[model samples]
Target: MSNCSGESNMSDVLKLAQKFNCFYLSGFRTSECKPFIVQGFQVGLIRPDVIKQLLSFPEVFHFNQDCVELNPAFRDYDTRSVKVDEVLKELKTKNVFMTLKGWRDECYEVKTQFDTPSLLKMDRSATCLFGIRNYGVTINGFVRHPEQGQCLWFQKRSASKQTWPGKWDSMVSGGLSVGHGIFETVYKEAMEEASVPDNLLKNLKSAGCVSFYFESERGLFPNTEFVFDLELPIDFIPVCSDAEVECFEILPITECLRKILSQDYKTTNAPVVLDFLVRHGVVTPENEPDYIKIIELLHVPLQTIYWHRNKIKENGFGANEIQGSQ
Candidate 1:
């Protein structure tokens, strides 16, 4: 009585299992079922009777085809019968919910209730009139010696770049893609901007980060940045991507701090760079007097900067507190 074609092969079933992380529940029903596919695997809703039959299968854990086991903790729930929004809310909080192959429609239905923006429209527009929500990864390359103290590596933004053309900034930084995790973004930006390999990434130490709201003429950008510190050999050559970086410089930590404090850095986003260093205790008040003045000019509250640092430590990453104007 199953609607599924008897012709459905083991390869197809395996693909489904890999995509949804679930075993085949039923293979007979096809006509009345609404099919969904994720990761190239097809899944379909089952009738109550078909659900019972699916449950009867020795390998099947749950009857819901749209719910898949991401981990041992996930239990199958009938997404067809369940309210999508409620399920998505639960999924967001839990972070462990895995969808069956072809369950994107259910996910979309849930996303709609949370006031999610149109990804289609946003993708089309190059100029973000409203601030585009973005989470970025930052890496701070440090060189140190037993006798000589620490130095920091910085990259000069490419002249062709739109925002901060030909200005010195963080060694590496970039926005995370939708659904990309912090570490993934960090690795990606490092590879793209600095040509750092994956093998070297594991050796980098995370020095923490600064969260800030930046409003500019172009649009508002909410940056949740993750900072990493890496101590490399003195002879290490940094390969800069011409598309993203124009050049690289290694400067003494004190000198770097001084430049940032003095506001002599030509980078358009220098304020953000300086704020990050000062907020993270990398540039202490005693070490840099001009930093205080720069902070004063921006009228940025000391408490807010401190809060940004603490929030990153507590949460591992910052979230956008300010919603973008639609």
Candidate 2:
């Protein structure tokens, strides 16, 4: 990529994870955000602007000093989904919210836990407005080269992508949308984004998942990415079969880390790949001063934030305690 100079301004690898989960770096005193309550559970952390806009639909949203909550009467899943969808559609017609302008026609299940049933589904792009807990899969495609050692595969996102256009990303990345399971998303993205064949897909190994709380100009991203490592034959090369990727490259670990730290790299996937490096021994506790801190940043306790509502309420959850739950 013309944008990459193979230079990184980041002095410590921990900085990458720190940047991703910046919500904690703020001293956990988030007075600007509001809790997005669903079915008596706090599902997302709503931003100030979004909260103001959501309050406009008084019939759909009600607020207490503690948080902004959905209508309690819309009890069932289907009813909540329909009511939220209707509001999202109206918001789409207006250009005030940039998130609605980038709608993918894809919906993300809004829930307290990934294994639990969804309370409702919302447009993927608009989920940020509510600081929704999003799930996705990230695969690190690699090969043990005879001469070059282990190298990682990277994809340049399609320039036309709504978010992070033309940025360097994981070999294969896909979201666990409304109906897709974790491994199912992995295979689906592997084929569509990198065209990895079935034989190589068998090598896909689940390393674990990385969770972080990120806030961007768009919204809060409490993302948990299930991580996988796939070892391909040294002779194999990736071919992009989908419009999502512009091209692919295979770079050794050192160079791959630099690419990750580059400005063109996706911030959300940084912790994902770093977890892979930590597991593969590219980054180690003996060598890196902040190795343990990086690990903590990659595994934020997002899954239990909603599950332990009382922990938050007792904490006096400044800013609705969603931000403090970190």
Best by TM-score: 2
Report lDDT (CA) for all predictions: 0.45, 0.84
Give model 2's TM-score versus the native structure: 0.91
Per-residue C-alpha lDDT of model 2 across residues 71-166, encoded as one tens digit per residue: 999989999999999998888887778878899899999987787789999999999888899999999999899889999999999999999999
Poorest lDDT segment (10 consecutive residues) of candidate 1: 105-114
What TM-score does prediction 1 earn? 0.48
Residue 283 Cα positional deviation in candidate 2, in Å, after optimal superposition:
0.8
Per-candidate TM vs. native? 0.48, 0.91
Residues 1-326, candidate 1: write the lDDT tens digits: 77563334423212212222111122211233322221222222223332333333324233343432112222223332232233334433543322221122311111111134322112201112222233457777767756667777888888876555776787888755445567887887888888887666777876555443343333333334566666676666679755778888888765664555333254333434555556556756565444443444333221232233234435666424421211
